[model samples]
Target: MDEQPGLSEQYRRVSAWPLFIALGLPIAEIGVLFGLVPIAIGGLLLFVGSIAGIVQESGYVERPWNLLAGLGGALVVLGAALALSQLPGFSPGAVLAALGSNGLVVRGVSIVVAGVIALGVGGAARFVEQEPI
Candidate 1:
């Protein structure tokens, strides 16, 4: 007869998924940036992968509040990015218009900033007390 895994073993297995997702997102994004994959396909993969990871990690498939918080975080990041693009000396439209532009650098910096923000949100989410239905 096969023995069942202990609680700690099960917890360890479950906890590893988020780390895989955190590492995978940057790799997927880099592949898109490097033209290794089509942008639409890469974006679709990332979107689906991210949502699945969020649902699995947060256990929020049946709990809408966590999903709402995640969506709100994404919107905040998007709004900040748009505002930054309009600031003096950082217009993305102008950056792309110039020949041999620093668009890659801008993109890299934004990715790093977004990653940091995501980590912050994830860390904070852990501290929130969830009430059972």
Candidate 2:
């Protein structure tokens, strides 16, 4: 007979991904900004890690705590992005001025995209059926 891992063990294993993403990404971004590594490499790491964390957490749709952890990770990533965008000569207002009215369109689209992602995270936690252990 095959022995399955206990619930606590399973949870511990599954929870680590979100926790790492939520905590690690910002540190990595700061390191990048401090010139510890090439900006391209650090940016790529941040982007991939964020996507992986979100996708991994989506698998835990039945677990509210896991979803909440994912949301926290996403927020951390968003904060990092905002910070990066403000660096040196990349201010949003300056870019928006260059783009004229099209900047408003871009901002509106981004808001809609963020809303959809938020809905997915919250809706999955509330609506998805948990599998029996």
Each model's lDDT comes to 0.49, 0.46
In model 2, what lDDT does residue 83 have?
A: 41
The TM-score that candidate 2 achieves is 0.28
Model 1 spans with C-alpha error above 4 angstroms: 1-23, 26-48, 51-58, 61-100, 104-133
Residue 121 local lDDT, model 2: 55
Pick out the ten consecutive residues of candidate 2 with the lowest summed lDDT: 103-112
The TM-scores of all predictions, comma-separated, are: 0.33, 0.28
Runs in model 2 deviating more than 4 A are 1-62, 65-100
Q: Give lDDT tens digits, candidate 1, residues 1-119.
A: 14665656555444544664566567657754663333423342344346645675677575333443454366346534644554456555664453134444444344434444454
**Predicted structure 2: lDDT:** 0.46
